[model samples]
Target: RHQGFFRLDPHVDPISDGGNVFILGFCSPTVMSLTPVGGAMGSLMNQRAVSTKSWAAKEDIDVLMEPRTLCHLHGDARQLLNHGIRMGVDAAQLKKQGVNVPDNASLYDWWGGMTSPVQRSPMRLSVVLAFADVDEIF
Candidate 1:
């Protein structure tokens, strides 16, 4: 479980790790956005060179990850793109903007889908699993 605002900058796995990473959303239904900056070209500098082209052509490639969603990042997607959750304002600000910030009971129902509500906290959890090749490690 994790809480608070964060932005993971664009990066590739230095250890290689089979050039793959998986993220499974467990709770909270907020949208996760991914932007593919460019095709993997071995280094960040090379990736940036093509970023303009990628951004111009990125309209159809942006992804919105939903709750219970499983996302796979590999190859160029893993090495040349950036993904992050939107940082929402405080509850009061949200309410002022006409967003219904869920109360504990509502949040409990939203997460658990149970008639009996349980205490809820501002926690969002996602499990990340990375895989690597044995030969690469050895």
Candidate 2:
């Protein structure tokens, strides 16, 4: 994902949010700056961001997941929050943009340890599973 790229699922209905979402991360050659910025908070500040039309009293992100992580969001987490990569997430660009290094960008310190090929590479690999039905499991 790029520094400017981001997404928020705006689904809010009973048993909606596509039932549930599971993200399995992967990378044959992992890069420190390629982790996804997830927003799994049930609400913003104090208000809930359930429906697409519902505006929150405060629009603050609540959580961030690590690289090579398995994230599962269901119930209120899936229905009431907009969970996914947030904007300005690129670690390199963050320095140029003068944005403070986000707390989740822990890999920045490990940049010196990356292998030569992986150091120059920028990639995001992960399998995202959405629960459709029990039959889908088979």
Top of the candidates by TM-score: 1
Number of clashing pairs per prediction, in order: 0, 0
Give a tens-digit lDDT track for model 1, residues 1-138: 445332233344453567678878655544344555553322333333232232223331434345677889876677666654333334443344455655322222111111222222356677878886565578
Where does model 2 exceed 4 Å of error?
Answer: 1-17, 28-59, 89-121, 132-138
Runs of candidate 1 with Cα error greater than 4 angstroms are 1-10, 37-62, 89-121, 133-138
- lDDT of every model, 2 decimals: 0.45, 0.38
Judged by whole-model lDDT over C-alpha atoms, candidate 2 comes out at 0.38
